[model samples]
Target: MRFMWLPIVESVRMYLQSLPEIAETYEVDLIGNLPKGGGSSIEIDWEAERGAAETVNTTGAVAVHLLIKHRTDDTDIWRAFREQYRIQNLILQEIRRLHDYILTNLKIAVKISATGVEPLGDMVRPYYGNELILVFEWKGAIRDGRYES
Candidate 1:
């Protein structure tokens, strides 16, 4: 398929990439709708949690998924688990950082409903040495369409 470009999504990607914690680790890559691969990448992917009608004003939800991976040389089971734990915690910290960033900067006004983290297993396409998925749920008022007489 041909490459697709989205300006709004790119803006979102830049927002994630600009985060100090995330940038310090690696060049922030916005996975967008593309498949994940490449050794050790930090990516931000988000989707509308549900469809919305064409209304003047309404609330909507967006599920933001943060994917983080760091290649490690440690092979021992215990050491790997410890490394995984560390990466998971760091990613969570970064997610918190992003949440705060959005609250402070995004004046459109979105409420973060929930946050969570889960392990992405090694068998995945990315084939991570250590993988973690951080989830942030954001709810905000959306204005769509024009009011008719």
Candidate 2:
């Protein structure tokens, strides 16, 4: 049995990179976490933990953290606020799109549990970031003392 998370992250990265608006508007980067940088970028981190297998059922969770950071050289408050809202909208759209696709496409009996989005903070100059969290739980049959879902 295999439980690879990178494939899911890669899938998301590819989808985001293919979006015309995101491709032309932002530099979407997929990594374990956010690094020090500026401009517009995105980072998606996959986290998961295995659960004990019962007599006939196996379960676990898959979570992903999607972080989006948008920065600008301009320090004007109004402009910065405008940019923030614009980037926020774009990120939200992408998150919704990704979630819907995954919920419908993944073959396994995985279920999306909770999702949330929040502003990272207001520290960096002319920069705004939002964090999106997605959790998926899988409950499936055990096979040969192993879980494959």
What is candidate 2's CA lDDT for residue 118? 79
Count the clashes in each prediction: 0, 0
In model 1, the Cα lDDT at residue 58 comes to 34
Instruction: Give the per-residue lDDT of model 2 (tens digit) for 9-125.
Output: 665777678788767756766764445664577777777655543455555676777676667777676776666566556655656566566445543455554477777876476
Query: Each candidate's lDDT (Cα)?
Result: 0.47, 0.63
Best by lDDT: 2
Q: Residue 43 lDDT in model 2?
A: 75
lDDT of 1: 0.47
Q: Give me candidate 1's TM-score against the actual structure.
A: 0.56
Q: Which number leads on TM-score? A: 2
**Cα lDDT over the full model 2:** 0.63
